[model samples]
Target: MSEVAENIKTTETVAVQPKKPAEPLLSKRRKRLMSDPLDEDNPITVQVLGICSALAVTTQMKPTLVMAIAVIFVIVFANLIISVLRNLIPNRVRIIVQLSVIASLVVLVDQVLKAYFFDVSKLLSVFVGLIITNCIVMGRLEAFAMGNKPYDSILDGLGSGLGYSWIILAVAFFRELFGSGAVFGFPVFESLGLAYENNGLMVNSIGAFLIIGLIIWAQRWRNGYVEHN
Candidate 1:
């Protein structure tokens, strides 16, 4: 009778043990992780990390879009891998491991571009390889991925990637539209049978600088973000 009673007590104790609550997939904190970079913490206009690529590849939308996609892949996967391995990584070699991970992903992206999208790859030239040294990718791995959980790191990566993507896309949009009167090489104005003169300024780096500056100003104005002087 005591054995049965003890068994019952054990079962009851086991049954009453509380389970940890599952975190919501898109908790308020997680949503902020995904949203903050798109506006207030933008990599390009706000953080000012990837201006060179913006200047170089954004003359045409096709190459710019390809670069954006490549970056998004690299950043997302790199964050996930690093976050998963964060604990196992030795502090002294963490930077080296992070670089190795980023380099491997960038090589994969570069090869895929070369194998299938050879023409765009050629257009991209060294730019795809240059992603290895991009500040945004390195910065995210160091800052967010090194400390956060895999899922949170991924959301941070997506946020930063999309933030970078839209800014370059916006710049490329204006540059392509005015520089060549096209969108994704569709030749929009040409299709409309309107003879749109390509703006020489929009075809040059000066054009990108001007557009980026205006965007920075406008975004800050809209968001009311101010530098602490």
Candidate 2:
């Protein structure tokens, strides 16, 4: 009788206790947030964000690489700051707050580039400052960082920044290869002893546009992404 009573008491205790949530190193949704933007949800190719910088800075691989690193630094830090302060920001002025955070990070990036990469910074010029207005940084902050935990926001920023980085790097690769017959100022054509004329059009802003558009098209097709009517 006592054993039966003790078993009933144990059963009641277990029934009343709440189940603990899973605490893995990384949740499934967090991983998705980090990875999806790399391809399927890419900010540039899929969402079509941050096209101006892609066109402006992609003429040469050197400057383009510097710009990509700068953007990644700015975006990751900005997202982290905003995510940590997400709940404290007022709704009426949230946009302003986000912009301020982004602008500060951009300044930090610009200064670091100027200090460490003076020549590349000169090549970049106003474009580095213009990162303050980049839609990708602001968009991610508002959409993902604002609503997510700091770790998830960091992943989202890293993914989005890389998404933009790889596309621009590809654009720069082609532009430098065909436009100047070189990659990062090394004469590939000359080194190979092959005669090749640099394509003037490939060094132009229009070339960046065409390349990025074609890349977006190819990515969408590969990913089976279609627009709705």
Candidate 3:
């Protein structure tokens, strides 16, 4: 009887001891992904990071959409490449490496845009190349992608890029409609006799500025970032 009791106690102890604790690796990875800068507080909408491009190519729908897609591709791929090579990059020269990766991808995107959408590409001109300077790309590398896994970094890049794209598209929609009387090159106000027909409010930079300002105002209002003065 004494031997049986001892055997039962030993078996219980072994069972409890073999039960493994939750791995910190996966939990840590998940936390990193969830806390990425994209969803919680987007640079474009919340911090209002890249408004330059928003005001530039937003005069037309096609150019705006093209710019959005290009930025998305550049940011995502750049983040992935940087994450993969993060370990090899010397701390002193990390910024240089990040810039190189972003510039290369931006150039690639520019070539593709020029080849396929020549007319729209011409309208975009230097602005497309300026994607390299957009803070969202660099911010992702420095903030989220540098220390995270490749998959999480990719998603963070994509989410940040898309967040920027959405705001730009929205601003462009308002600018194009009110400034030009057209949406995506389709004549909308003609039937209503409200069309400008030539060189309307939409084609000018001031219109973009005003529209972007109003957009920023609206966003701030909705998010309670700004109170009415």
| Top candidate (TM-score) | 1
Q: Model 1: per-residue lDDT, tens digit, 1-229?
A: 5643443343224323424565577888999999989998899988899888988889999999999999999999999888777766899999999999999999999999999999999999999999988999999999998887677888999999999999999999999999989999899998999999999999999999999999999999998988999
Evaluate model 3: give its TM-score. Answer: 0.77
| Residue-level lDDT tens digits of model 3 in 1-229 | 5643443343224334433773343356555454443434656656667877877788878889999999989988998888777666788999989999999999999898888889988989999999999988998898866776566677677778877887778778877777777789887788677746555666677777777677667766766765349
Q: What is the TM-score of each candidate against the true structure?
A: 0.89, 0.89, 0.77
User: How many clashes (backbone atoms < 3 Å, residues ≥3 apart in a chain or on different chains) does model 3 have?
Assistant: 2
Candidate 1 or 2, higher TM-score? 1
What tens digits encode model 2's per-residue C-alpha lDDT throughout 94-157?
Answer: 9999999898888888888788888988999999999998899999999988886666677789
How much lDDT does each candidate structure score?
0.89, 0.85, 0.76
Q: Given candidate 1, what's the lDDT at residue 221? A: 95
Between candidates 2 and 3, name the one with more favorable lDDT.
Answer: 2
Q: What local lDDT score does residue 71 receive in model 1, on the 0 to 100 scale?
A: 95
